[model samples]
Target: MKTNLVANCHKAITNYIHHTPVLSSSLINDIVGAELFFKCENFQRAGSYKIRGATNAILNLSEEQKSKGVVTHSSGNFAQALSLAAKSIGIRAYIVMPTSAPQVKMEAVKQYEGDIILCEPTLEAREKTAQDIVDKTGATFIHPSNNTNVIIGQGTAAFELLNKHANLDAIFCPVGGGGLIAGTCLAVNSHQNGCLVYGAEPFEADDAYRSLISGKIETNDTTNTIADGLKTQLGDKNFPIIKEHVSSIIRVTEEDIIEAMQLVWERMKIIIEPSSAVTVAATIKSKLLVKGKKVGIVISGGNVDLAKLPF
Candidate 1:
């Protein structure tokens, strides 16, 4: 909520998470007619920026709460993040994953020593399963993006980005449940001079885009986008922050998402998940707005199932 809270979170999780690299591609810059700095969170511990928030959330728990352990429902990166973060702090993690979630993500959660609870692929099922765990085990349920500590923790990525380059004209992030972009808005506004925050969302699942215009949270009837990580709707906690801080939300098509993913893999030689690629696709789609400016792109994660490449 406050800049100092984010700074304190950074201090708490400094040794726990990676200060991921900021990379730039000349070819990419030329293509967009802007100097782009890509914060490569794909190299982060647990292979995503979720670790920042997950670690912070775990570390902030009291001794009593820590004894009860932690639990969350995530089908992808956050599942892996909470597992690894809790393991690092010698706490147990309970992960409720949908049966339809990619096998690779489920396996990664196990690899990090998280206890997995498989449930039907529905929001209701996932939440119910997680709540059952909390009731039975007394574990605290951590909402992936809605928790205040998680939001502050996620802000660290942009904090580090602005620390390295303070003159960015804008920072772009892919919005799912909206933690990353909400946190990003706080960090950039708190630390930098006047860098604007922008959100990238898939047209197929543009709840955040619509929510901003409607002045309330929105949901999608069907999530038919390849950017699986951005399929979730914005939470109440993060929606207000995003509405106040984010400059705009750019909705990109499925084709543009694939093209952007391929471009990063081919040109930057980085393996970014489709969710991460949405930011690049949005940036490309709004080339004129970013032209002759310094831009920062937050590559949210690199966790992808190799067998399911959308190329």
Candidate 2:
């Protein structure tokens, strides 16, 4: 829970994870009326920021734990991240992916040499399958966004961002299970004063926003947004940190999400998934809030299915 834990994680996985570039867009700044710094985690290994946490989690495991292997249930980025990290570290990875997960992501996991366990497309089924794997193989289960090590690992992205741009007035990130934003909160608090942290969430799956208001975790009745990565509900581990440190959760529409994704692709010439665009969409939606300020937008990942693009 200490901010210094992020520093430890960075040191542990420095050789393994990429210190992703922080790029700016003059046009985006003009549009949002703020100087925007985009932390391009899309270019990160495994094409997402999840690798930071995945690598740190694996590296922190004891030799015996490493021998037994690590497991996680993720349909997209984290599945690939854990697989690649484990492969790089010479440990086995057990990935429990829902059958409805994109074929491209599943293939990427396989490409990383993950042992895939396909299950029904339900949270219950995924968790049960992962637990079964742990029971049978004694593999350690790493929750994608809820584990302490994972959260500390994720904070390294913001830590890097702040290391390069220490004077940022604010930082924004997309919220799903709350790991990224929660870690970001610790990063901003540890590194700078008066720098706020905000979370962008899809209106279709605004559990984080509602959870903030309700002072408890909330679930979605249906996740019908293009931002598949932001559909998951907040977890107890990350929700407390988010509720304590995040300034607010801005909900953006599906159309806005697509527009933002298209803008980054066309203007920045960078490929980003719908989840990554939520921060941009929210920034644009709340232009006045960030006007005349220096803001950092954590582009969560770029693991989009090109063949199934919304734009």
Candidate 3:
């Protein structure tokens, strides 16, 4: 990917997306043994950083494609993002979601005027359903993590982060489909500074970690993690960038995920989902990876189900 892609994407989507604040906690800094900056995408529009990519992807669409509309399959954040993004541009968005997805997220998508198509709670079902929509409506298919435009858009979050804290030693982000982290890598790489990028993953859905080891995209044998958003596997498009730029993938346990989630809520007083907490958990679990170094952690989103609080 061109280095200028992230800069161009940031410019294109600046008005559409939030330049979310970078937060720091003395307590968290003490625990992690580093001056950590949390790029809080949890406070972003549609309640996640997914809005950045969704808005950019829609903006880059041809007028004919926009007129025909767009379609994608997402369990939560991207569904709400695409819905809101399309609505802002006065276009239709078809979101295929798993039947088992959080009700709160499903409702958020509806509130954004997205047409939700329910499918079996499986990746195959979601993809097939979304493809069916594209086939019938002649709508453009925007893969949540796998498309080039979407990846560039996702990088804008990190681009914004790096712009604020140009001297960061490293950055840790939760990896699911790898879009966010891949974009993050691009953003960090674009800088002349030698800032490293790391990915955090739940042990239950360690496909990205395993893929990095084997040098090929891998699938999860089980999707039993509390970090619902990190359950998706990396795609061919984002995986290559991740493998090339990410320093390493740290796998954290479910217990650690909850502990980190509770820590951020109790300390930072921020509402972050389990997926977002994975980055913090990984940092706490592997202090050796970034000891004494000033680092940045991307708080990916804040769309947790209130009724299902793990704490």
**On residues 1-311, what C-alpha lDDT tens digit does candidate 2 reach at each position?**
47678877888999998889999999989899999999999999999999998998888899999999999999989999999999999999999998898889899999999999999998899999999999999999999999888888899999999989999999999998888998898788788567999999999999999999999999999999989899898898999999899989899998999999999899999999899999899999989899999999999898877778786
What lDDT score is found at residue 267 in candidate 1? Answer: 92
Q: Give candidate 2's TM-score.
A: 0.98
Evaluate all candidate structures by whole-model CA lDDT and list the values in order: 0.93, 0.92, 0.91
Tens-digit lDDT track of model 1 for 39-124: 99999999999999999999989999999999999988999999999999999999999889878888899999999999998889
TM-score of 3: 0.98
Candidate 3's residue-wise lDDT over 263-290, tens digit each?
A: 9999999999999999999988878777
Stretches of candidate 1 off by over 4 Å are: none
In terms of lDDT, the poorest run of 10 residues in model 3 is 282-291
Estimate TM-scores for all models: 0.98, 0.98, 0.98
Ranking by lDDT: 1, 2, 3
Of models 1 and 2, which has the larger lDDT? 1
